[model samples]
Target chain A: MAVYTDITESELGAFLRDYNIGELLSYKGIAEGTENSNFILHTTGGTFILTLYEKRVDRDDLPFFLGLMDHLAQRDVSCPLPVKRADGEIIGELAGRPAAIITFLEGMWPRRPTTAHCREVGVALAKLHLAGQDFPLQRRNDLSLPGWQRLWDGCRERCDEVEHGLEAEVSDDFAALEAGWPADLPSGVIHADLFPDNVFFLGERLSGLIDFYFACNDFYAYDVATCLNAWCFERDHSFNITKGAALLAGYQSLRPLDAAEVEALPLLCRGSALRFMLTRLYDWLHGPDGAMVQKRDPLEYVRKMRFHRQIISATEYGLQQS
Target chain B: MAVYTDITESELGAFLRDYNIGELLSYKGIAEGTENSNFILHTTGGTFILTLYEKRVDRDDLPFFLGLMDHLAQRDVSCPLPVKRADGEIIGELAGRPAAIITFLEGMWPRRPTTAHCREVGVALAKLHLAGQDFPLQRRNDLSLPGWQRLWDGCRERCDEVEHGLEAEVSDDFAALEAGWPADLPSGVIHADLFPDNVFFLGERLSGLIDFYFACNDFYAYDVATCLNAWCFERDHSFNITKGAALLAGYQSLRPLDAAEVEALPLLCRGSALRFMLTRLYDWLHGPDGAMVQKRDPLEYVRKMRFHRQIISATEYGLQQS
Candidate 1:
């Protein structure tokens, strides 16, 4: 529901002159993607996606994100590649916002994730991590431990407006994660937000992944923990052990986790859950009234955080020990 | 921005089992169409639009609207044809709402319409009217004069909150329109609401007209009046006579308006303006706060209503006399 910047025909026609894609046939504002405005573009040459980077996306980080997609696609990862303009620049300006066009991927993100979907996503996630190993650009994961602290600072006093004991619970979780946070692991570019909505599929097969705005350099196992929390949870907030086992097995088939990475899984899961909860809490409390952007309930992640806090070992997540 | 009903994968798959369309490759909720929830579905066979009728559209009117589209497309009107299910029924139930699939039309509605676009829509509207002549379905226009009074009744008290003297101005308009409303004129199935958003175009050629929820039996000249108000007004709310002339000229080239129809254009335009104003006012005053449905400004129609009040003859709208 994000068409914040309206592009007129003449403006679009002017913008398309820089690209090799032929004359515009038709274009529509897509109702997906929350962080930025997206449109499905049809041209005489081919179909593509036109994305206008909104205020939330940092303009300086555009090169890193676009370059990662370009690099990964070259390595045979199924993802949308940014289209280069006639001037060899991938980014352009339209309707007073930074905009770019990318090749459109054909698949729908699974609304309801099955065990098969979880396993395929785990395999795809491993492939993405391996493919991104040698990428030149380096972006710090800003939503990691320190970034979580900054986000928490903004909402500490008023956090109880959402849930009664949310503030103290979050504070305890932060103290535990900060003390036990792993300093070193196999770090690479991780799809930091590989939620089901970001991963596309056709039937049981994985088609591609999208919404790379959150990709950053981080611990690879942290990415796996994020997926364990995101994909294995049922609607009732209970973790499905079968889906968790499948996801871990699928990932281990490609690149098995070391002892240290496996040992850090529970804390990583709790930290990942907290990161999402903090952001959702911030948006829930501070989002403008009557905004078109749908606000997600932070309490869902709160439940996940509590579930992760009780886990004693990776085996509890149905991860088998070697 | 209207995806009021969310359809799950299993539900959508079950719904498609009743149709002959092949396996569903993907589907996305379209941000277009205000009256119903629309999804652009891609399948192994072809791409199509799936519309779930919302509460705003009467359930009984489904046959007339779907039949009219089927009727018009068969007559070479170039609109979307309703796809029939395996049981030979056009409508089915999905997500507890009446739903149907229609062949997808290709084209974009112009954001900034030019005079050439205006002329083409006039020609298309006239073609639509002629094509719908022999259609068996008969639906009275609910947004016509009587419907305007009913809608106005809900907003008359709070009308002043929108504008200082809106209530009195609208009351005087009702009194005048009731006394002088035409009893007998050329009548047939007319698209009561032929706004620019409902008409799609490829370059300067009109691709098609859509959103037939408002299609009903009414004066054909009144549809022409609706188009004049919709397409011939500049951003400043002033009438663009050149565009108006082009539209009337394009329409007359196909089906010339009779003498009585031509003479009644000014009042028809005013009545058309008031009809839209009343509906917009009702939605403006009563629409749920924080709802995704964007409420249109009722004052725009008020301006158009005032502009049409000063129009004395069809000649002012560039209608040439034979």
Candidate 2:
């Protein structure tokens, strides 16, 4: 567990003096993350999660993550609500790290989530898109096309050393993508990393959503493509058509995608897969040398990139003609 | 560009004093990583890439990365050979960062790598495993099983907040995987990141391999599984049996996998996918703010995870019974 900061029970109680969340009964470090230290705090009022930002996270971005949760909660997005301190500040300092307290959401992360669960998540994600429509914040997807090229440049030398011709091929693909990137689309806040582990459920229904760290302004349908790439695969990495249909149908039910958005699904999915492949490749090339955080295999995303590359036709993504 | 140390051309030239390489012609910053600053150095001797270790990479690991490259080169592995100083020193200090000079490989990364390309990569990877059979190094796959759980613990809270129920599912999967992990398997040096970007090609023939950063000791077949996950997927992130067959055949032609290895392929593939999914998920939850690095959609790996989950039958992975 990445414990950027450690806090004792008494220390946490002193920190919670400003919040209205009653007395802190107990707190323990929740071992998880590559960036921050997390503590599950049980108080007289209720349970809450206290996060202490580590080196990986920028101090300035705390408001965006915390504020988004607060905003989403106010809009009934079924997520953790950030608790502001008595000084009306949501962000605070704890254990020598930037910290914030959020209401502990009740429910469990589903282990055997079904296709129906995926569909529900799809619908919920669409709802989140809708709910975040008028959010006052304006953060762009900084890690989009340009960011990809930057990463490619960083690992280009070593890239060819591992796999033959990977650098040139990816460069060519990236050039093509850059040459013809989509311009106009229905854009809004996108939950960039809506993986199954980031969601909580009560049975087949989605109880809540968590982790708004990657939420940024981007094409809404791209989020759907991400979901399809995530929730519609069988055990052999084969596309599960039934699950795909359910997920798509569920998304369309809430926020009907524009024709342009639908048409761009395949390309977006490809771009999305490439985005991951590049990041994973970069990390694989230069992840931390430590016993704490393990380096990820970049090949998984490489497979995803190949799959997205195959999705040449719009129909392949089950989208109708624009 | 993440230049941990900003040195002038003269400073860099002075730093390259004892190297076998000739005078530096030019150096340009490659703005492309979260861990290190890379400069493509043009010298009278040849074009080389100079990497300056940044925050994410430990300075101590410089020896490992450099030594591994030297070892592979000595064993006839087509890799980027680390350049040593005239004083027989491989490590150096540049701009207050641990730095090294390495030969720049020539080739393109396959954008639309075919089944043939997959086969060649498989063969080369197998050969790499064979070459490393007696290497003096013994780096364990720290990212294998326990590392995943550690990451899960760090990101569990924000994980649910991001995707909903994904945390529990991942945890359960991790637990199940831990309970039945393969106790015994042939272990050796594996190029864990066998992605297309990591493989270099000079036309139809395989030229070289890059990115040995994730290379470590593990089941040799796990490397094959990593290749399959990377190279056997169609554009829609779906499995392609033809590609899979070619890749496997190529691997067998060089170093055939045993019965136990074949039987373990499916689980290893699943485990490989899960490893990536978890890491990507962690990055999604706690990506650095304003950094050039892109956070890959964790959902893509979620689909991959699902696919691996469905591979309950050994026959599904083209394994034959002994």
Candidate 3:
């Protein structure tokens, strides 16, 4: 649904002259990414994805996003590699927007993620974290605590419109999280939004991870928390512990969690839930009328927030003590 | 922008089992056709397009549309051929909708079509018409005179919401067109919606035609009239006679227009314009609020209708007098 900028044949022909990829056979505007225009470019060489960064993405963060993919792919983390131009720059300009072409990954993201899918996602995410440790670039996770607070403030007055008691419940949750939020967890580059839609799999085996736009340097445990919120919840907003156990066990097999990290897991889950809920709430209140981007209901995250609040230990999430 | 039906990985895997196509490698929802939900399916065998017919298209007409493409491809017309299932059935049920797979056609549609592109389209369209002459199944062109009148009746009251005096102008247009409507012309299967978006080009060569959903039994000259409305005008709504001449000459090279057909060209063009304008106006007035499908301005077609109304001869459309 994200074909905001239309690329003409002559313009695309001129643009491809800068790259060594073979003659352009065809290109299609794909309904893949949300915040940018994406086209599936076919050439005599191979198929690739062309993304034009829209205004929602910060221009300065292009290097960090594209470079992270480069670093991860180099480390054998299955992900797209940003194709460099003859000038050696990964980013180029097309249709008045910053653009880049990346190698097309071959897999479909599971629509209904199973327990096996959760386990594979956990392994892929940990591998990404380990691979990203040695990367030179850094980008602050802007959707962190302060950012959540700003988003909450923007939508607090109108949040009740989405759900009658949403505003007060979120306000109280914020106060609780602020008082007990973890200050010292292991930090690294994290795919801050590791939703099922962003992870691809060929059958049961995880093929690759995508949508690195939300990726940034943050507590790796926070990234894990986001995955827990995304993958372990059923349609009824009920936590599926078997899926949770599978996800956590798969991650711990790669990078074992410390005692301190285990204790902080429940609170981090609440924080992650808050981050998504606040953003969704802000969009629910302030998004332009009739936007093509379907609005994710903030109340879904609200239910997740409420579930996490009742949790007393990581054990409740089916995390086994090592 | 038309991914209305969400197909699960499991659903797709089960669906592909009925076909001879190899293992499913990947599938992505594509933004190609406006009405039906389309997904580009990549399998071990090859790439293909999976289309789920939405409510906008009638289910009964599915055979005619699929059969036409199959027939055209058999006769060497460059278009996507519908892939049949094991039971020799071309259509099947998926996600509560009728679905079919077709071989993916390679090439991009011209965004800013030139005179060369227009000529190529003319040649390819004529080739399609010739190939489809032997097509067995016949589906009536629902969006012809009666269809236009029905659409006009539905939107006439609120048509002024789009323009101040559109109702009166359109009424006069209807009176004139109905009186002069051709009772007979070179009749055959016609691609009623052969817009530039439906035609693909690889460089200057016309690669293929697509979106057979609007194909039906009609006057061949009426199809040409749709193309003239589609390709021979600049963005400013001014007719480009050079492009028009190239298109007509290219088409005539294959299927020469008879005297009666040539004489009815201007009226056919006017009818074509009114057909599109009425549909656009109806959609504009009655479309569900916040629809993802972009509503095209009826005013553009209104201008075209006005242009065709003044033309006294087919020469104005660049048709050569033999």
Candidate 4:
């Protein structure tokens, strides 16, 4: 629900002059991608996505995010490749914000994730990690352990407005994650936020993954752990072990995790849960109410974090010992 | 910005099974059309618009609206044809709401309409009227004078909050319109709401008119007058004679207005302006403060109605008496 910037026809015609895509036939603000304003563009050439990177996205990270898509598309990973201009520039300016056009990927993100969808996403996740290994640009995961604590500090005083004992429970979880956080085992570009909404599915097959704004250099297992927190949860906050097992099996089919990486899944999952909870908590406490932006409940992640705190092994999450 | 009805994958799949359209490739909630929830659905066959009629639309009016589109499309009016199911039904239930899929029209509604676009819409409006002559359905324009008076009574008390002495000014305007309103002058189907957003264009050529929720039986000249209010006003609320003339000239080229119709243009335009103002005034005083639906400034139409009041002849609006 975002079309913050308005582009006039003459200005848009001038902008499209840089690309080979033919004259604009039609374009509308699409209700997709919360961080940036997205418009589904249909031109004489073909359909493409016009993204105006909003304030939430770092202007400096434009190169890395767009470049990663360009790099990964050259490989076998199915994702939206940034459409380059005549001079080979991928990024351009529109409505005074850093804007770019990417080829429209043809698939819908599943609204309700089945066990099969979880497994397919895991396989695609592993595939993205493998394809991203040789990518040149590197961005450190900012929503890691330290990032979680930093986000928590902003919301600590009023976190209980959302829940009675949420503040203390989250603080203790952060302390445990900081002490036991994994420093090694495997590292590469991971889609740190590979939720189902970011993964497109056409029928039973995986079509592509999107929203590379959160892609960064991070532990591969941590990425998998984020998937556990995101994909394996039921509507009532209970963890679905079948979904967990299927997702892990699908990932392991492509790239087998080492013993250390396997053991760190529980802690990594807990840390990932805390990372999301802290940011959501920040938005929950501060987001402008009644605006078009849908505010997610931070307490959903709180329950998941508590579930991870009790996990003794990856086997509990439907993983077989490697 | 409307997708009030949330459709799941399985539910969507089951719904699509009822139609002959092939497998669903992608479906995205489009931020277009205020009355209904619209999603641009892509399937193996081709792209189409899937609209779920919201509470704003009357359930019984579905047959008339859908039948009008069906009838007009058959008559070469260039409107979206409702896709019928194998059972030959245009309407179906999805997400517990009445839904239907219409053929996707290719073109963008001009954000800043030029005189050329104005002319194109004028020609198209006349063509729609002439084409709709033999259509069986007859829907009274409820949003006409009677509707305006009913709406104004509801908001008359609070209308002053929007403007100083607005109640008196509007009351006087209403009294004048009721006294001078034309009883007959080329009656036919009129698109009661012909705002720029409902009119699509390719370059300066009018691609098609859309959002037929307000389509009903009314004076043809009144519809032309609504266009004058909608398309001929500048952002500053000043009337652009070039636009008004172009639009009226375009309409007359296809179906010439009678001398009486020509004489009634100024009064009809004023009445049209008041109609919109009353509705917008009601919403302005009543719209939820933080709701996503944008409440239009009622003063815009007040200013437009005043401008129309000063006009002496149809020639002043670029119309020549035939």
DockQ of 1: 0.66
How would you encode candidate 2's per-residue C-alpha lDDT over B1-322 as one tens digit per residue? 2334545645676898879798665454443334676666666686777888776666666666678878888888888899989989988888777788888765545767788888899789888888888777678787899888788788887887767888788877887778767888888888888887777665557878877777788899888888878888777888877778778878788787887887778878888888887777888888743243547777777777778787866556553343
Tens digits of lDDT, candidate 4, B255-305: 999988888989999999999888888778888333556678888888988
Per-candidate DockQ versus the true complex?
0.66, 0.01, 0.84, 0.74
Ordered by TM-score, highest first, the candidates read 3, 1, 4, 2
lDDT of each: 0.90, 0.75, 0.90, 0.88
In order, the candidates keep a fraction of the true contacts of 0.55, 0.00, 0.86, 0.79
Question: Model 4 misses residue B294 by how many Å?
Answer: 2.4
Models 1 onward score TM values of 0.98, 0.50, 0.99, 0.97
Best by TM-score: 3
lDDT of 4 by residue, A60-134 (tens): 999999999998888978999999999999999998899999999998788889899999988988988999989
TM-score of the second chain, cand. 1: 0.98
Error of 4 at A160 (Å): 1.5
Clashes of each: 0, 61, 1, 0
What is the full ranking by DockQ, best candidate first? 3, 4, 1, 2
Q: After superposition, how far is residue B316 of candidate 4 from its true place, in Å?
A: 2.3
lDDT of 3 by residue, B1-322 (tens): 6788889988999999999999999888887777999998889998899999999889999999999999998888899999989889999999999999999888989999999999988888788888888888998999999998899989998888999998999999889888989888889999999998888888998888899999999999999999999999999999999999999998998998899998999999999999998878877889833356788888999999989989999898888877
TM-score of chain B of each: 0.98, 0.93, 0.98, 0.97
Task: Encode model 2's per-residue lDDT on A1-322: one tens digit a residue.
Answer: 3444545444566788989988655454443455666666656786677888777677877777777888889988999999889999999887788889888765445545578887898899998999888888877786789888888889989987657888877877787678767997998888888876667765466878887777888999888888877677665667776777778778888887877777788778878877777877887888753233446666666676677777766566554332
